[model samples]
Target: MDNYGGHIGQGRARDSQARRDAVTVEIGYALCSALFLAVVVFGVVAGPALAFELSDTVQGTLVASGATLGAVLFTVRVVSVLNRFAREGDSTDGDQPSQPGRTNPDS
Candidate 1:
């Protein structure tokens, strides 16, 4: 059931294994993308150190800054992606039972 869009799932239950799989795949994508982003950012920031003949302190500082920035970007990417996924999967899409732990009396 694609309630992520108020009617997207089409009869799929919210707790189905397929839904779980989708969540898993989304998480994997977030992780991989974040890692790729972090590495690229780190390389862009720290690459100078690897290519230049700067003093030890400057090289160290650049490396540190690169690592820090990369980590920050990685966190941001993962969080933003997961948050988007969560917002899209909200039970407020109306797929959830009107009341839990009870049968619908009108059924």
Candidate 2:
């Protein structure tokens, strides 16, 4: 009905399916990267306690702090990554047509 004659595909369903697949891939990537980041952060924070003979209290504190910080970072990373994806998608939505199409019924 509009210019450029719809997307060059079998149908809207195909495009929708492709988009879903792309989103799934991106989500998987985000989660995997976030987990890796969390693990690394935890290891760095707790490394000294684990390596050297520290007091029980000190070790526990370090371990707990590490876990908390790692969890926070993991959450932030995932949210930020997904937000970025959403923002990028916003830009490409609804192709901008040079030639206007379809007049308003009321107007």
TM-score of model 2 (CA atoms): 0.78
Question: For candidate 2, lDDT tens digit of each residue in 24-87?
Answer: 9989989999999999999999999999999999999999999999999999999999999989
Candidate 1 has a TM-score of 0.72
Task: State TM-scores per candidate.
Answer: 0.72, 0.78
Stretches of model 1 off by over 4 angstroms after superposition: 1-15, 91-107
* Per-residue C-alpha lDDT of model 1 across residues 1-107, encoded as one tens digit per residue: 23245565544554477678988999999999999999999999999998999999999999999999999999999999999999978845544555688763224
Which 10 consecutive positions of candidate 1 have the poorest summed lDDT? 1-10
Q: Give residue 99's error in model 2 in angstroms.
A: 20
Q: Cα RMSDs of all predictions? A: 8.3, 6.6
lDDT of 1: 0.84
